[model samples]
Target: MGAADARLPVLEGGPLLRKAFPDHWSFLLGELALYSLLVLILTGVWLTLFFTPEMREVVYTGPYAPLRGVRMSAAFDSTLRISFDVRGGLLMRQAHHWAALVFVAAIGVHLLRIFFTGAFRRPRELNWVIGLTLFVVTLAEGFAGYSLPDDLLSGTGLRIAQGIMTSIPVVGTYVAFLVFGGAFPGHDIITRLYPVHILLLPGALIALLTVHLILVFHLKHTQWRGPGHTVRNAVGKPFFPQFTASSGGLSVAVAGVLVLLSALAQVNPVWNYGPYRPDLVSTGSQPDWYVGFLEGALRLVPAWETHVAGHTLMWNVLLPAVVLPALLFAVLYAYPFVEQRITGEWRDEQHFCDRPRERPVRTGLGVAGTVWYGVLLLAGGNDVIAQTFRISVNALTWVLRVALIVAPVLAFVVTRWLCRALTEAERHRLAEGVSTGEIRQNVTGGYESDHEPVTSFRPGAPRRQLTAARTGTPSRTPHEPEHPDR
Candidate 1:
């Protein structure tokens, strides 16, 4: 309506920005990812100003005395200079590392939220795909950035990466060459990965994140059924002031926490590890948590090798490093479609979020997956666990092997039963309001709870639609829609 608004037509859609957002705490998990990424980008830019992405070896002769004249990569030396010489360099580097760990962690938890709540059904399936893609790109970005320091631990990680790539049967070697920019520990690796870590992967991550947010805005936020909310409408605070304050405050808090942690916590101490050597490696070295699961899998798979016609197949490496992770992610990406097919329903997919208790099978699957990953994660530190507990390493490995198979199946069965019980409990509570501390006498003189039927007890307006997502319950209210979760 004004000249300024006319000049910037994008501002004309300001009223559209008034869209409501659910105040649910679980909804903030995605925001954690977004804010942590902002921190990572800002700190990463600061780090890149001094980082040298060359693999050339140079003798270290810096203020730190331990490795005063030892040979190390230029990448590592620049990393040392950035750590000791540049003001706030250590803080920024640590913050960047911590932020990356948090970023991937947020994505993982956010994905679990979406899956358990059935938010990836129907119209939001494409959004799920986009979110998953962003997740994957962020992992790549983290790995590239992690390896740029060229420490001993990172060198081991790269070696594992190279081996995984070179295990792809026919074209593995060529792919590895392309990725590493030649043979193992290629001289040009840091140079090649510099652009990818700083620009390419981050660029893709930003673009994909933009698309994910755009799609979310288009569909509006999904929410649980609350008081006065219907299948056609979502209930929550609007974005203009209240939710905006919450978002701003959350962003600041996330940044402050990262800063504090970076100040106090030491992560990825590359200087102590010395420079990466192809022939040298340290004992008891481990990667960051996100990569830990894969490492665990690599350790767990039995050492079974196959030889056929002079070609070798290392099942131990291929199964855990390559095939398992691929199949797992493939299943995750395809789950929405698979569920849709099983249910044979789609017309009412866009409205209210499904309560986890309302979806027993999905809840069970989520639990099973969590347990499976948890076992593998613990197995990743098998050597440490054995040493700490003073047990044989092989014995610990065998125990983990049994646990991996047994735990997930046990979790699946228990979760499904728990979900069903919770659903039944909710029904009983709805039929009879929560028990007050009062007792009443029945006709036979037996005492019982004096309870009143409470329709709903959650905050905000009561949900009008009693219809579940899978089945259409008869509507009592005049304006209620015929379909469930419409």
Candidate 2:
């Protein structure tokens, strides 16, 4: 209605609509994470409207008649009512859970892609740290989100968390009491953690994500391959029509899959387990799949006694809960610096993805992480293992203890060797074209094979200048252009 309004740049219809996108499947992982986040926000908003975050105990009169006489926290009761009473609430809750799982998973894969490719080399180092922080926050969010349910499984997870916190030598108990507002799952704990799960962490993650994107845009994307391979140096398309359109399609696809899985594959059937009872310990208690490694570590530790400075040491509890978490965080935070030191190189720019084999050390670490996580995951199932083998839990724990020490070393060594082999293979292929498995017979009947040719260009090259050609210029005669054919 106003001239100023008319002068404003048009939105929803822009030049970006005409942009082209790259058709690489690898780029879809980030889009999957973004789409999952979108779904999470939508579902979270719906759930917040129906559920109360209060910690006060209340009598339940929900559709689930079995819970009618039971007294539970308002948060837990509201969650159950939402799932059974409110139409579509269960679907939304499941979607939220699935989204959280996907978000954590995508970020892990994304970081791995960056690491193997040397994308985190220079300016992107900050982004790597941001990613790592996001991962930590996501795990915390998952823990809090599940704990809000106040079911036996969730309660057990909370107990483990509390124990881990209180395992610190000097200030552990105080921190635990502070965090939980008293003993494990104190009266106010849910009320305290609800905001952290639903609001604070989400808000912080969004802010960090925004910053991550801005930095990515400012720096442009890291790409693979040579310069002459494309008209441009970038790997993917612009973030306008092409990239955005493809991303939208992929997001829809991923969201659809998550929704389908959520609908069909249920998680955390808290109702069956009922409310948290300190006296009741459920058989086969397990944390979420993502946190299983930590749980496994706790299971693997041997019961031990030590004395230091007139203080009795409970090594089993302290090592898994306090020392382990500290070590994990420290290693993650120190990775960028460690890598920088190892490579002893600095650059203003880095690529987005690198071949994993090219970065042997990083690949080795990844393998080592996998092995470590795998061993711990097995440790978490120590009971099952003992039952299956008809062996003692103590013996199982001891075996895992030894594995915890040795498995990582073996993994790192094997991974490093595999990477070296792959690198050598790549070099061989680069030196001689990739093998097609066809043998050629030479003129004299000897067998020969064609190989890849070496690259003509160096690692980096300078631009060449263009000049005009002289018409009818006498070509330089062989050996005597300056001597005039003498």
Candidate 3:
């Protein structure tokens, strides 16, 4: 046999090679995340060559004149060198940061598509859980990267993080000591986080991504229900030529876009923030965008704390920093099962997806959660927003605080109503075609409007009946005999 024939799957005739992948644009969201992650990995490897993840004190004498004689962490010093001294190092750094942002955002939108479509139901629950775990780890990985630069803003964040850790009632302080390698701004936090940011977390993320792709390949993808689409069959492009080109081209395009963004837009200039000094504070410092939600939550939380039996409980820190995220992630991890429980549709296989209009409850839930998180994220930037809009920071905080309470409730109610309304309207349109903007005069000389049924939906005939009629086939019902002449 020739080389091509020899590589064939024995007697299977390359059956697995032609696996179908749904061609919908929504599917690109997952590919966007994968491509962004690839960018992160590539730029991260480059960064590792110059990054010094040590917290040793050093006097800066680098090219950046702002902190010429100031003492800073070695990690921060290296960051400055990477920005100013190393050629293209700043570009790569920004590329990696931007890639991380897109990665999380793509994952978030992908989850929305999967959830609203009921694609996570039956045989896909495990994949959903795996995706959730990946999200948690991705968030942690971003946080680790954010902290590695050892700038003032990141150090302040670390201090706040230590406070949250110590608020765990009993074991919090011990956990903080163990993780921090000692007390606040411990001697070796950057060294500790280096392995996690560059090695451990990335390793876990890649391994999980492998398993996720394997499962997706094995289980096949879910497509919308339509002609020739069902539990056993999907309608889409093949894997070899069309899908490969489209997905690969899109990934490369996204990487190029990130490169352009990095070149044009400066991000996270650590030199400007200076080194992490426990006593010094910058007025307008802010964390990365992904970390903004937590910052907002922390700001919105009421100032409350308690002490029981000498164990202090910082409720303010605990609620927003610890309890809130924990609860939200718990809900996220359990959402597929929760939806299944509520709907009571325990089918083993689902090859078709539900339109958003068909799943009002799930759609409403998604909208509510998105609104709540978005409000929190905006709250994180309230300081900047207030200054820009010339409003009081305190006033903006209160507005977002009230929004945090009322927005989700309002979003849920409004979304449910809208979905139900749209669904009913769609049903009507399906039964009776849209207005043709034509009117006719009756015998009595009064104008009467006329309605037309869609071509496929002939009043009494729905899709099922229409298909049977066109195919000249009868369904499970007995049909009256047609005359031989007819």
Candidate 4:
């Protein structure tokens, strides 16, 4: 048998694969995530074959040679080799980075869709937790992957992490030292993160994803629009050859596009930055966007010092790095419960979904979260903003602090209003015909078409059902000829 034929599944057919699935645009979010993961896997496989996950000092012998014999991590040298020497290696590396970026973005947007639509309610809470875990793991995976390069950027990030760790009281320094395997410029640091990047985090992510998919299959998908939103049944098609084929096709298409982009465009050109050097501080360096919020927080926090028992404490560092993140994650983990309590809904009676407008408070919280993240993202480029706008760094930090508080409230209020307006508009449309733009004179010489009533039905119900019967036709009498079946 031919290789392709040899892989065919042997099965007794129950239904035609082509006819079993729905082609809905909303389903594309999951497809995008899946596609990015496929690209990640492909690029990662190639990278793993060439990479040396070691932290030993090495002499760089690649295209870039500003500091050839400076003694950098083996992982960094291997990355340099991959970028400069191996055929198509740079493209693969860029593709891998882009894939990780896209994967995280897709999952985030997907979560927003779930939250706004109330898909995280009730039976789906576990799935929501799974998704949140996946998101956290994805972030960790990205951080680990970025750090494995041991570039100036990665080094800076490690320093930030160490700072965050050491910001804790008492045991903070010990924990940081333990994690990094010594002090700053610790030799064992990259070595520790190497396995975490390629193995540990990825394994955990895969396992969580497996569980996530199993739960999704069990619960089916939550849908939008029509009476379907009110009903518990999946308002969609079966998951068979149709969804599989289309999703597969989309994955291939997205991967192909990313591959082309990676090959044609440049990203993360760390060669220009040379290797990680402790003594030399590079200007205009920044962490990746995903980690920018913490950086922003660090910048905004006012410097302070306190002393107790002959030990000094820096409240600025502690608040931003340790307390802030703890607060954020604690809120995230507590949401399902907090919301359930506030809404006075018991776990057993909860549905798998909610319409965005149905839960105004939750939707508002989501919008506020986005605004908070966005402010931090902008703050990540604070230097750029200061340079561009001719402002001082301190002034910019103050502005960001004000914005961090105000922006989310504004965003929440505006989003809540807009969602309500849209819901009302939908309700109005269902109750009445499209509002006519023009008026016409009737045969009786009164304003006609504009004032004409197309149908009269109660608002918030399907139009097609009651359009003809006003309040809907009464059930036929038992003696009626139409009631023969009854």
Candidate 5:
């Protein structure tokens, strides 16, 4: 290594190996996303080998007795064959599906962590945009993959998608035609989506993921405020052995969890749903969890239309399906810039993470958005919920609609208030020090409790220590100063 480095001046590995990374659990969320994507790629390749994406009619003569001699699409037939005949094919398929779900979820949570902690400020804004783009691309990839089996549930989902596409004002029909190749349930959709799912989307994801990681390395990580930590210096484990070993173990653990889930939990049972029939609709048919918010939006919106100059405008479909998602993503993409503009903190780069309490408005906004999404997600399953609980679906819808508007406002106010309260409490703690749990008798028979001076208090140390103390192992003695250098 020394000889190679001496011969090739650019081959030096010391600086790269010595790079520091913060040791925090929240930082692992991004790693979870990356590792799950790896699992997805591996299992996707395995499933791709046995799967046929063609939509031509074929007889299901596989080992499954119930569907024997049933006429189905080649796509569905191949799916059955993979599930029943190919060794370990079912496991791979489930693992791929589970990994995809986990990948989307991990990216979402990682983005939330970034947002709430102010990690998306300043120099990291572009990376935030890239992260959002990754999320959007992954969603498209998932929907495409979900439809590849050409089963009844997927067919229903495609039907809704077709309706959504055709609801656009001027170009809706053309877009739908271009996507399905002619009309609804056209023969070419599966074949078309196959390449996109396997090739195009994955390629885009890999490229984006690579660039995201490069920026992370170049920009360095944001760290919490602590003793000996600063915007200019990162404090934690080095990349060579410490961070690398822990990260490798994490990757293995993610893979193992995915495998376990695949082995035990069945997902997307295409066989039960049967082949796609244009006229048939399955009961309680639902999309994957990530797609549920859109479904919920479609359900919650009222069916309203307008006629203008002999043209019909679909306010219901367009508002919920098209405009809502566009607005949501646009806000997400532009949030960092918007916040920078509002706070006038564009010139100085933020390397230290902000506590959620420190930025009450941002935290409240985050909570409000989350509540809105959660309500929509619940609304998506309104029918099932109504049926199970023996309630009126219309009534339930009305309640959710009201909540869709009111819940967010309430949540924002509550969250903002709580953040302020926590901030005030922290200030008091800083001023008075932590309670030492001891009382003494004064000379005049008055009783008072003694308090230890917090000589070495770090800005954010109290929150961390309080959290640790809740877990029953206080990191420091109450009698000792929280920090030796206040």
Candidate 6:
């Protein structure tokens, strides 16, 4: 070891091992995403060993009594076998699904943290684009895997996908043909998607994830603003013994949580849904949570079509699924540059994170975007909600449509006001010091609370330390005399 270290100086303990990362809880989000991906890969590899990706029609003779003798595709049959025949196979399948869900969710939340805190500025803009790309790729990967089961629910999802693809202007049919390998419910989809799900998309994810992490390390981790933290210096634990240990523990915790969820929760029960038949449709069917927004959008859009130059245009399918997601991702990709151009803060390199309250417009915009997404997600379940409440589905749809338009505006206004109010309150607190609970009589016979002078205050400091009082000084009115233990 000593000789190798001497021969390769890079192997020796140096600045890389001693690199400082902020000990903020929000920083753990990226680590959570990484760990979730690791769980996904491990469980996915296990499932792949027992699963066969085939579309040939076959009679199920599996141990599951309900599915026995049912005519189904080889893909669905293998899924049932995995669930019942192979020990611990169902657990791995559920874990893989849960891990994918968590992975997408973590990346989303991590991006929000970065955006709100202004961490995606200047030197980190490229990383922001890469992170957004990761999100898009992850969504695709998830949808691909979701459809591989060949069950009724997934087949319905694929049908919708095919319709969306066929809605494109001139090349729609060709694109659909290329993807499904012939037509809707073609024999080639499962076989084709198998490699993409397990190989192509995951490979792209790993490559992009590698580049993203390299950029993070090369650019240095962004730290919250505090006394010792600055553009030139980061104040936190070293990478080797401290951050490494904590991060390792966090990975274990994440894995344990996934396993626990897999054990407790049953997800994507293909037996219950039965095999996909193009003529039959399942009731109360919905896509995964990550794809819920698009589903919601499709449900909300009124059926409309136009004929231009003898070709029919499907505004309903085209707008909601294709155009909306495209615009959304485009805006996300261009936000950092657009913000820089708008604010004209072009030159400075920011390493210390900005407080959300300090930037009212950005905070408000972020909140508004979140509110918009939440509304869409809720809309995705309008059918279930309506049936449960015995309300008119049309009424609920109209309500959601109105909310989709007005709610975001209202959220923006309220969020901006609150941010401004918080900023002013913080400024006032810094200037006037904290109030003591003790009430004392003044010279005019009026009771008033005393103010305690804070000894130290800094942005991102602990709340307890923010109210710490100075030892020697007691703030009082000029008319009052100093008293000990009064």
Best by lDDT: 5
Question: How well is each residue in 156-262 modelled by candidate 6, as lDDT tens digits?
Answer: 99999999999999999999999999978899999999999999999999999999999988899988644444467678888878999999999999999999999
lDDT of each: 0.83, 0.72, 0.82, 0.74, 0.88, 0.87
lDDT tens digits, residue span 29-99, model 4: 86798779878988998999999877788887666768566677788899988988999889999999889
Instruction: Note the residue pairs that clash in candidate 1.
Output: 226-463, 227-461, 227-462, 227-463, 228-461, 228-462
**Candidate 1 overall Cα lDDT vs. reference?**
0.83
| Count of clashes, each model | 6, 5, 0, 1, 1, 0
Candidate 1 lDDT, tens digit per residue, 183-291? Answer: 8998988899899998999989999999999888778888776455655665777775778899999999999999999999999988888889999886888888888
Of 2 and 6, the candidate ranking higher by lDDT? 6
lDDT of 4 at 376: 85
Ten contiguous residues with the weakest lDDT in model 4? 477-486
Candidate 6 deviation (Cα RMSD)? 6.7
Mind sharing the TM-score for model 2? 0.84
Report clash pairs, candidate 3: none
Cα lDDT for residue 466, candidate 5 = 48
**For model 3, the run of ten residues with the poorest summed lDDT:** 477-486
Higher lDDT: candidate 3 or 5? 5
In TM-score terms, candidate 3 sits at 0.90
Candidate order by decreasing TM-score: 5, 6, 1, 3, 4, 2
**Per-residue lDDT of candidate 3, residues 214-295 (tens digit):** 9998789987644455566657877767788888899889999999999999888887789989998777778877778999
Q: Comparing candidate 1 with candidate 4, which one achieves the higher lDDT?
A: 1
Clashing pairs in 2: 117-354, 222-352, 432-452, 433-451, 433-452
Model 5 sits at a Cα RMSD from the real structure of 5.4
